[model samples]
Target chain A: MAKVATRVSYGEALVKYGVPNENVVVLDADLSKSTKTDTFKKVCPERFINMGIAEADMMCVAAGLATCGKIAFASTFAMFAAGRAFEQIRNSIGYPGLNVKIGATHAGISVGEDGASHQCLEDIALMRTIPGMVIINPADDREAQLAVKAAIEHQGPVYMRFGRLAVDDLYDDDYKFELGKGVMLRDGKDATIVATGLLVQEALKAAKILEDEGISARVINIHTIKPLDEEIITAAAKETGAIVTAEEHYIMGGLGSAVAEVVCKNAPCPVKIIGTEEFGQSGKPAELFEAYGLTAENIVKNVKEAIKLKK
Target chain B: MDAKRITELSIIANKVRKDALTGVYSAAAGHPGGSLSIADLLTYLYFEEMNIDPKNPTMEDRDRLVLSKGHTAPALYGVLAERGFFDPAEMKNLRKFGSFLQGHPVLGKIPGVDMSTGSLGQGVCVAGGMALAAKLDNKSYRVYSILGDGELEEGQVWEQAMFAPHYKLDNMTIFVDNNGLQIDGDITKVMNPTPIDKKFEAFGWHVIVIDAHNYNEIESAINEAKATKGKPTAVIMKSVKGKNVSFMENNPAWHGSAPNEEQYNQAISELDEIIKGLEAQL
Candidate 1:
């Protein structure tokens, strides 16, 4: 299948699922073309609002619309949406538990050419701190589309992270998406690779590499980072004895920390985290990922390292 | 409009001031200056202006008020109590743990509080969103938001100033309590947001200047706002930092400080005198 950016899938999903609902109002802060919210604007101009570079105002405006019974979708770059307008999201949306969906695009270092300032490595961490905030980071196009449907239906403050970089299709028509549930792709008894967002594809590739090397690796796609599927994570720790976590975000508070938190509490196991420890510089998306050690090779290395610690 | 009605509102406004001070004193911490400044406006809104039923605050199609200046929750809680949204006795639990009356206004926690606000600038933008929602549904329920002069320092406030007009939010009206004081000393000394009227006009709003404490002027400005078309209205009411309470008036020290036993008694007596005078007029 053709490679598609999750942001594009998000735009298409907004039209397919969001446009049909009259109460779904979409707001963008002058990044409609990049965020793909323009697709929703093109079809449903009446419900669309171009908020013009003010992410803070855009967030609170969505909260206000939600009060009047509208499912307001506010889209912007993750750096601006989750980083710049965090307090607005917390006080206006999270405090009241309003029905406002933040479609944060350009999350992680995959946002090529936009250096450290635009790349939002801390979005998951920032959004994670807010109470009752549902965080969704889909792995691919199909999951991104399905995630949008889930966000609109959940009826509370939801932060959906999407990427600017196009990723290959990971799931097909047979795939089912569930909120707060992790999908087990390839099961193994040696070690598990728990990954989210674009890294899930890398995890499956790493699992294949591990099998070639006579080492079994389980692959699990953890799309929902918050309200994490603790059962699956704890099961992976107990069944596999060790686990490796991969994501395009920081090592401190993304999927790695979330998985570790559950593992330490539920099932004691050695866990290795695969992500950037420092800020990202402007470069090609593939080059940045390679430079940051966010690759299939690195996941394989971490899986072996975690297995060693377990032994 | 009428003498008897004005006397009645003045008496109610005095009661709101007493109740607000009572809540602040009981809590031993809360904003009293801006709360007192906007007490008359809140009284006017809850009593004479807004299409709200304290009994049915969640009624669809009812007008909504977003207290964008959320530090003034004591005033909002006071007016809600006066309007019968809850028992007046509940004001004593202002910021105590497990109280519905949080430090800042929270929507679901407090009845008749249309939007949750505390961190400045967010509430005004939310109010604009509420106005847009009303226009989208063709609902006649108007949206009202009160902003502090100091709050204009927030860049987000200006963003909403631009948004309200760009979307043609005529159903919305904003009351700027130009009390000239923030947590810091003077707003101009801190950050000059002077020419407040010109700023709103430049942003495509029908600007109206009124004495915030005057019932007739508050009523007239709202009337003018309702009559205007294709744009929202900004009623910049020049007000004292603290009004009614003699010692608190114009004193930035009273901005967020809770009055002591002696001061609270004096404040209550001052409001009692005003209420007695208004009743004598009746």
Candidate 2:
């Protein structure tokens, strides 16, 4: 078995980039330690603002800072940043097309212990619906650091989703990351497994398992969900007749739905979406992943079904 | 300030009240009560106090005025039109489809609107951000935001109140239109935000309480705000829900309702009398 590389937490990645970017200001809604921006706060107190559970005010204030040419990153749990401050994000940041990076940590069922209230399963739908919003779900800590740097340079609203649990790194230290591009990790012909966030690692694992069984499975990392890499996805769909989408989000209006929208519009193909069909229950992260059908085993099963349907 | 000039501003305020009423009435929708109540404050800021260019609305160094209680956009539009930001003829397009004048203030659509604000409690925070930006840029531009007393019930307002003081945004001045009525009923019944002055003072702001309709006090309070430094100022302007118009005064029904023909005629007469008194003083 191939050894998996060590992964970095999104919080650690933010601190590494935040130290070099003086114009970068971080705002936390009393979840500094939880969201991992506390590392940045400790290093640069002047650039950090702990807004103490006021997500709406933080969103607006970030918009204000962005208007003044400062790259402001507002951090909170995905539920609060995406759900609580929905209107504030829509009007203050999205309406003005401000360069504000929203780091929504504890996304999806990975926020296991905190339960459904903290797990933001619907953030992608809410954020993607807003005009000019860039949605990014980094696969690992290395990708998250690159995503943060890229988002800071991007001149519009961007929502970077990160998980609470640690995952194996999918990319090398020197791997290049772009804003609106997808990366193909493996080549195959029978079926394609397109995934994002923590699911990227799962999809890669599933592809390896499928390769052993004499079935060729292609693995694609769709990090940037919005402004989706339709060309790559379309080409992959045409090359590999069937596609399976895996994500740590709800089946509706997330990575799966985004891919479906692109493929349905551009290239119609047999597709299967693997994600949570109901609200997540309280359990260990690994347990929840299995319970919610968000495992590589499930991806392998869904891909086989999709490949059968393709024939 | 000279008495004659103050009276001239009073006359302007009266005309603004008429314009606000007529705009709301013609549109068949708007917050006429609060708009009328805030006319003097808006008139005092735009015509007499603020250093803004009607031609260059987006000038970097121009003083910014945000209507936090943006439902009272008719009041702002009336004052901005009187200041020649746009033609007064456009005033008739209030709340109409495809008009620059929306139901609420939208920036860039209308000149002199610093921020698009329809959602209450957010405009003040945005203004605070603008004030902070001005300080950072080392510009002499001041930011003035007028909020509805009822809108103060929003928790975000207090969050911004705390933030403004922390930043020492003395370049910003916040006015609370204390008309005491919201859409449902009295502000106290809806959500009491009493002791508004102490609330600002507690938030580390320089508090000033005055009659919002009185032009002299309004002008003087704004002048006092300019002199004070190192902290933001909150002027709690005591105003009636609907000022001058007899049928609408303190009536919550008039909060968003336009006046009918007879009611509009009587309201115009009252405003005319107030304007004539100010003209005589001028």
Candidate 3:
């Protein structure tokens, strides 16, 4: 199957899900082409608002529309939406618990040659501090479609992060989307690789490599970071005795931090967080992922190291 | 236009000033300068302009108000209390523990507040959203928002300045309280966005200038906004930092201050005299 960017999938899903849902209104801050919200604009021009280059105003406007019972979605790059408009999201949308969905694309180091200026590594950290914010990071086109639909169905504020890179679909049309449930892709007992966003595919590949080496690894796709599936993560820790978390985000406060917070309390297990350690340099997505140690090779290496800590 | 109604609104505006001071004095903290500056504009909207019911503030077709300079919540809380959204007595619990009134305007906690606003440069843009929603839903309701002169420094204000006219939101009106003073001192010194009117014009807004304290002018400006059809309106009102109360008038230190017993007594007595004289005329 050919690969598709999650942002492109998101735009396609908006028209599919937004047509029947008449209350759906989309706002973009001068990045409709890049974020793929232009697809929504073409179909629903009356319901779409181009908020120009102002991300802060876009957030405030989204919050205001929500007050009037409109299911508002504001789209922008992660660096602008989650970073420039942090307080607007916190106070206007999250604090009020309004029905606003933030469609943030180009959210990680995979933004390629746009470099550290466009790459958003601290968005999860900034969004996590806001109260009542639901965080969703889709792993592939299939999950991205599910995440967009889920964000539309859920009531309160949701920040849905997508990527600049096109990824292969992991699930078929029958795959059900749940808000906080983790999907176990491949089962093993030696160790569990908890991954999110584009890193989920790498985890599955790492599991295959581990299988060839006579070692078993469990691969779990954790799309929602907040309201985490505590049951699945704890069970994985107890069953595998060691966990390795991977993401295309910063090492400090993305998926790794969220999983660590869950596993340490219920099941104390040795965990290795695989993520970008510093700002990204200008390069191709492949080179950047390799340089930042966010590859299947690294995940396989970490899985071996984690199995050693299974003691 | 009519002297009788002007007298009545004048009395109400003075009372609003006292109500705001009372809330601030009770809380021992708040932004009183900008609150006092925008009181008359707020009073005119609640009393004579807006299509709202204090009894049923959440009416679907009701007009919306967003105070973007949220530190001045004392003014909004005062106007809301006088408009019968809540008991005037509850406002004295202003910033006290367990009070429904937050330091800034919160939508659900208070009866009449349409949008939650505290950060500068956000409320006006939100007001644009409310107006756009009214257009989208094909409702006849309108939106009104007030911004402080000092708040013009925030970049988001210009963003919305570009937004409203591009969408051609004729149902919305923006009022900039050009009070000349900020906490640090004069607005020109802090960060001169002095060409406020020209900026709006360049951004495609129908611009109007008025004396904020003039009841007739305030009413006319809003009417003109309603009449203008293709774009949003921006009303820039020349105002004093602190409008009433002799000692606080034109003073920057009183931007957010509580009056002690003697000062409070003096301020109340002076406002009481003005209210009584206006009542006599009525």
Candidate 4:
């Protein structure tokens, strides 16, 4: 499959669902083009609202619309949606459990040259703190398209995390998007490489390299991190005996931490988290991935280290 | 609208103020100054202006009210109780554990509260959204919101000032409780949200200035807003911080602090005299 950013598919999928549903409305905080909400705007201009540069206002507006039975999708950069307007989301949307879908793009250090300020690595952590908040971090363009559709159907508040850079297209058209279930891409017996977002492609490549060395590595894609499918994750940990969690986020409280929280309680297995330990810097997407040890090489190295601990 | 109705509302507002003080005194922690300041307007809205039923609080097509300056929930609770949303006796449960009377106006917990608001400058934007929905659904329900003078210092309020007018939310009316004091001190010296009328006018709102405590002015301003067309209205009320109570009026120290036993008795005695005089007028 061709490579495309999840943000691009977000715009495309929104139009797919929004054009047919009269209740579906879109609100943007002045980043329509960047967040890809402009795609829905073109097809359903009447349902789309531009709230200027006010992210908090946009979120509250969405909450208000949701109270009236409108399925409102509010979009902005992850930094603005999850950080700048965090309290609005918590008090206005989360406190009420309104049906406001927060479409967050440009998350993680991979936002590239925009540097540390633009990158949003802690969005998932902040969103997870809210009770009953559904979080979906699609790994590829196809997954993103299905996620947008699922978010439209799902009730209550959901935060859909997307990124700026294009990565591998992992899922096909026939792949179904479940809310909290993880998709095991490859079956293995030695160790499990649980990954999310753009790093899922790197984990696949790492699994292949481990296969050459006769170490069978299982690769699992965690699309939904909040209502995390703990049963599947625990089964993988128990079967493989070793687990390595990778994500395009801060290691402290993201997918790595989420998986570790599940495994430690359920399986009590050896798990190594591969993510950003420090803040990101200015660099090309590829350069930043390599510099931050988020490449296939690093995933392969972490897999071997995890397997050794199991032995 | 008439002098007789104005006197009747004045009596109800005094009870509202007394209950507000009672709730704050019971909690031993609350914002009494702002509560008392907005009591008259709250009484007018709940008793005279807005189309709402306390028994059927979630009725569609009913007018909505968002208290943007949510720390003054004591005033809202008092009005809601007086309007039969809940028993007035429940006002004494304010800030108690497991009590529906939370420090702020929580949406589901309180029957008449339309939207949950505590963070300054957010409720107006939400009210703007509610007005927008009324347009989309072809409903005729109007939306009202009240903002503190100091709450204008929050940037989100201006963001709403821009949005409501841009959308031509004619069914929306915002009341700025310009009591001129915050928790810090005088709003002019504390943060300076002055030129309130001109700022709202600049934001494309139909601006109206009024004395918040005046029943005639409050009624006329709301009628003027309902009559105006093609734009939102901002009725900026020039008000006293702690309006009625002799010791609390214009005092910023009472902005968020609860009254002591003696202080509560004195405030209640002063408010009871106003109620007596208004009743004698009837």
Give the number of the best model, judged by TM-score.
1
Give a tens-digit lDDT track for model 3, residues B177-198. Answer: 9988888998898889989999
When sorted by lDDT, best at the front, the candidate numbers are 1, 4, 3, 2
Better of 1 and 4 by DockQ: 1
Question: Candidate 4, overall lDDT?
Answer: 0.92
If the candidates were sorted by their TM-score against the true structure, best first, what order would they fall in?
Answer: 1, 3, 4, 2
Question: What is the per-residue lDDT of model 2 for residues A186-289, given as tens digits with 9 covering 90 to 100?
Answer: 99999999999889889999999998988899999999999899998999889998899999888999888988888888878889999888887788989999
DockQ metric, candidate 1: 0.93
Error of 3 at B116 (Å): 1.1
Question: What interface RMSD do all candidates show, one decimal each?
Answer: 0.5, 1.9, 0.7, 0.9
Q: Give the winner by lDDT: 1 or 4.
A: 1
Q: State the weakest 10-residue window (summed lDDT) of model 2 chain A.
A: A1-10
Clashes of each: 0, 0, 0, 0
Across residues B141-257, which tens digit of lDDT does each residue of candidate 1 receive?
A: 999999999999999999999999999999999999999998889999999999999999999999999999999999999999999999999999999977999999999999999
Instruction: Give all candidate RMSDs, comma-separated.
Output: 0.8, 2.8, 1.3, 1.4
Per-residue lDDT tens digits for candidate 2, residues B1-282, read: 687877888788878888888888889888899998998888888887788899888776778887889999998999999999998888788888889898898866788887778889888987877786676567888989999999999999999998889888899999999999999998898888998898899989999999998888997899899999899999999999889888888999999888888888899999998888777776
lDDT measured at residue A2 in model 1 versus the true structure, 0 to 100: 72
Off by over 4 Å in 3: none
Best by lDDT: 1
Residue-by-residue lDDT tens digits, candidate 4, B185-241 = 988998898989999999999999999999999989999999999999999998887
Where does candidate 1 stray beyond 4 Å? Answer: none
